[model samples]
Target: MFSKSCNYAIKATIFIAQQSLQENKVSFVDIAKEIDSPTAFTAKILQILVKAGIIESVKGVNGGFYIPKRKIKKTFLVQIVDAIDGDSVFQGCGLGLSHCSEKHPCPVHDKFKSIRNQLAYMLKTTNLEELALGIKSGETFLKTL
Candidate 1:
């Protein structure tokens, strides 16, 4: 349901959040390798993330990318989606019709509305901290095991 770049962005953010929790930073190269994305594509995604203030970048010899520890708890999935994919996923038609609104509903409009609402709710309520912790504790896998 998300773009490929958005998927990598979420993974990169969670990884960065985990490192931030440990008072560490990650280089873009490491982020790409860990998330199984190409370095160039991950670079573009990370640039968007940094521009959106979801992560920070530094340029010293020891510097890299990291999120503020306190901010991760408040960084909801919606924000990341918005930053990378915009709010269209939350507001677009189910069947990809440009005119699929309430007045001119698509065949699956009603059903998809419910699913979209559920997705929106999940994104709004879910924060990066819990996701980062899940990986940190070995309770979840960001990639296939």
Candidate 2:
């Protein structure tokens, strides 16, 4: 449902949030490993998240990445999705038509639109805090293992 990079971003952010609740900073290697993503790609995604103000990076021998306390609840999943994948997921056609729209609908346009609306609603309403809590409680996870 999301690009590989966006998937990694969400996973990494949620993991970082889970760590932040315990007042811990996570290194790039740890984040990548926890999310099952490539280290170099995860580093690049972290750069994007930092630039977008969704996460913070500290510079020092013991420095690492963390989401700020102020942002823990304020940062919604949509923000991360937007920062990494832009608004394309919400705007583009499910059928991959260059000009698909209500005016000239694709075969699955209406159904796709309904599904997209639900996805957008979930993304906008679900904050990282809730997801982190789920992870902490063992109700959810970044990876199967």
Best by TM-score: 2
Worst 10 residues of 1 by lDDT: 136-145
Model 1, 74-95: lDDT tens digits are 9999999999999988888888
The reply for model 2, stretches above 4 Å from the true place, is none
lDDT of 1: 0.93
Q: Tens-digit lDDT track for model 2 on 83-126?
A: 99999989978989999988999999999999999999999999
| TM-score, one value per model | 0.97, 0.97
| Every candidate's lDDT | 0.93, 0.94
lDDT of 1 at 118: 97
